[model samples]
Target: MSQQTGSLISCTFVCLLLAFFAGQSLPVEGANILGVFTSHSPSHLIIHMSAMKALAEAGHNVTVVCTSVPKVTHKSIKQIVIPLTEEEEKQLNAGMTGMAKEKPSIINTFKNLLGSLSMYIDKQVDVLEDKRFTDLYKNKDNKFDAVVFGFFFNYYQVGLGSLFNCPLILSWTSAPMSIVDESVGNPELIALVPSMNVAVKPGQAMNFKQRLANYFGTTLFRFIGFYLETKNVVFYDRLWGKIPDMISYDEAKKNVSLALCNSHAISEGPVRPNVPAVIEIGGIQIKEKPDPLPQDMQEFLDNAKNGAILLSLGSNLKSENVKPESVEKIFETLSKLKQRVIWKWDDLKHTPGKSANILYKSWLPQDDILAHPNIKLFITHAGKGGVAESLYHAKPMLALPVFADQPNNADKLVQSGYGIRVDLLTLEADEFKASIKELLQNPIYTKNVQAFSKLYRDRPMSARESVVYWVNYVLRHHGAAHMQSPLVHMNFIAASNLDVYAFLAFVLFIASLISFVVLRFCYRKCCGGKGKPQKSSQKSKVKKH
Candidate 1:
């Protein structure tokens, strides 16, 4: 053979060998991911889909076990849909529709109660003993390297994690890390980013009363959550069989190897007690190709000379339900404004008669709309998803928070100097107009938002990449046991030193007694001689007489 031909064959042989080794070095061919997401909320679905996409791209087998089918289309992932019963579905639909009259008040609450009971029963009876659920564990045919569970209201995911006996990671789509990062003791008080002092300087902090209110708000939610979950476990046991001792906060916290929060450092400040295992992989949606706006809306934005304001209440709130009076006020305010308005009013029939500059649509491409050069302000409900997107786009906001964590989110936004919080319940046309004008005219809000936007976008790695890295890290480290917190079993009082009340009381009592004795001694030393000597001499004189 010629020398050149022999060399070519050798090079090809080397290439094939390298490719085979590279394939072997990869973690595994398939990663079976079990994702539990909020059944009702699209936001959770969106986040789960994003993470699933990233995992799929990384060549991991992904199986999502969520309450409902998500919006995203992915061929690589398998979805396990758990359907709600007719009664449960009714309650869920009622909650979503805001139609309390259609069902008894106890229905929704009872559903949660029942769910907790059911889970408890399942655990006690070992009802999940069968291969249907535990099949993932026993099959030994297909071992899962890691399990990812959503941190929604349901605790069943944690139970499922226990069943699998694998490394578990929590994917929190909310702003506060308290649910997963319990080290800080108090989730609400611990600001995610302690460094950014935009509106309220750190020193000029919220007073005790305000802090108490925040604490109560979070604590109340947690208490109700626990009660509902426990009830579900009990109910499940009665219906099926006794479930094992599978559901526990301590177990979940201890077993969870890593936390993946859908938050960025720029938008969500530094989480307390920063640990290597807790990863903030926010702005996942921004990583995707944003849905585009209609051409007419684009043309309108292009033609607007004074810039535009984008108004949206997210997906849950039906624009139709907004009181007509509030709508009138909004229209009255918007019509007079010099700036053009692009409002996402799903049902526009109820909107006030149109103005030359005002536009209404069933939906708007929020990210694209925010990114538009002509868009100046975002009127949002302060959903975390919307707030994160707004931060990414660098658009200041007029936040009209309705419910849930939105009010708190708005407070953060206003405090951060990038938004204004307008009370939705008692909105006034004139006040609304004035606030909108102020936000538009104020250059600082724009400047601050733009600054944060830069920080949000200039991360070391994209949110998707960060999530993928940690998911793999958990698998590679055999569930990353080193990352778990040691104080998993401690309660609030024990963890906070409130459990030392007895010692405190003893010290206080001793201090009080010592103070009383000192005071008596001092009284005698200062005033006794002046009155006593004369009394002794007078008594002696009287007796001699």
Candidate 2:
């Protein structure tokens, strides 16, 4: 009995020792993350949610603050929903739909921005006032290791990190523009990297005129960003003035440790230098294996004997908002095709006249549908996300750009030989039909896109993996300040080297004046300070007479 008891005791001690060693070998727990994405656009929300899902899956506790919840969810994520008002939704929809129809200019764009800033501020303020959000600050024990903000010109929200005294991450759903780069003092080389609003063709060098457009476009974008940010400073003061550590929006922005941009140079070319703090996580939302299509969707694709075309104007633009004439034209063009068509229509009751070749659905899995072997062509609105996906799948496109970045995105596609662009506002059935046939019949488009797909997918790591690695890098290094650019701390004069130029100009002017004085003195000494030429005695006498 004594020997049996000794053996039991020895085995228990060995088990305890093994457990301690196993625990030591295991990975450390992930840091708690807070993601704030307040954009009303579902497309923009997807980019933010992708990152959140990735972080959560990597064992981090993520808290999301958004105007609407995304379809992508994970067990580690806790959402704090902030709903938008009816009027706000109407305004956003109107702006997106209307802008595509109107001609874009710097003046009109600035005016639109002024109008939208107030609405965006109002909507975001409502989110801040939500009880759940305030409680994050109210409960001192609710510590966050990092705060990731989905930046959409709302510079004021940087204060959230200040309130928590945590490291901050800023994400841009679109490509890196001057407005975003300037936020972190990243270089905005206008000569090389064109503004996001201006579309430059692939491999097309900018002429004086194109460069001028880029310069003005970049300048105006920066000016508008500054104007809006100044207003947000006031809003920040009014809203968080009571909090002792809350800093000005400008000051708080400097605390941003890193920025994740949804852009890849391979697809969106004219690659430029980025500061260490700016990381590109483009195509993060794209899945290695697209989600399985629904039963009806799969069946529809299987029935497409002549292949299929996917037409989606993106989530924000309701198809019903399309003019009746344009809708009929789209239908007429599709009806003539032997191929099947999948259209994303909001109002199934008023869909463009039904055809045997057309399939009408309120929503389609755009990426999944594009991935199908039968999908030969895509007609899209040129949203950055859509553009990225199409490029990733190597699917050729016919862009019917609506508004915002759509036109620019379309132009790049055309330039890249991946597709063509048609004006959606003034689309004719004949022209629309011609464009589709051109995209399908032209094998060159397919070839170019397929080549690009290889380049886009050739990366050191997947987009999701990049996000995980960088986010963890920030946490591990306590904000990774070592990687931040020195430019962040510089003012405009220092950043642009205007002060150096000014000083050099001053020195040049002073040297020129000294040289001029010395030359004049030398001339006088050489000629005895003569006012007139004494050598010309005959000419002098003739003049006197």
Q: Which predicted model would earn the best lDDT?
A: 2
What tens digits encode model 2's per-residue C-alpha lDDT throughout 1-545? 69999999999999999998996555435788999887777899889999889889889999998888786678779999888878878887776556655654445556665774346555776788788788988898999999999987677887878888889999899767766786677888889887756677666678888899888887777787778767787768876988877876768868888889998876567777888888899988888899999999999998899999999999888875576788888888898899999999988887778688898999777888988999999999888998889988989999987666777788888887999998888899888988898999989999999988988899998998888888888887888888888888888899989999999999999999999999999988987656456657768789999
After superposition, candidate 1 runs with Cα above 4 Å error:
1-29, 67-69, 72-75, 80-144, 183-222, 225-229, 232-253, 265-267, 288-296, 336-338, 348-359, 489-545
Model 2 misplacement above 4 A: 1-28, 104-110, 116-118, 522-526, 529-545
**Each prediction's TM-score versus the true structure:** 0.72, 0.89
Q: Provide backbone clash counts, one per model.
A: 30, 1
lDDT of 1 by residue, 1-545 (tens): 99999999999999999998996567644666665453455666777678878888888888766545676637888776554457754554444344211221223434433442233123322323323445555576755667776665444445555656677777777644445555222233432222111123223554555555545545655666667567545543443334464545445545667777777644456424456667788877664455666899989999999999999988656665466777889988888888889988876676667898899888676777887888999999888888889888889999887655566678788888888888776789878988888888999999988988887888788988888887887887778667655445577777666859978999999999999999999999998769988999999999999
lDDT of 2: 0.83
lDDT by candidate, in order shown = 0.67, 0.83
Report how far off residue 227 is in candidate 2 (Å). 2.0
Q: Quick one: best TM-score, which candidate?
A: 2
Candidate 2 Cα deviation (angstroms), residue 441: 1.2
Residue 278 error for model 1, in Å? 2.0
- Residue 512 alpha-carbon offset, candidate 1, angstroms: 15
- Scanning candidate 2 in windows of ten residues, the lowest lDDT window is 100-109
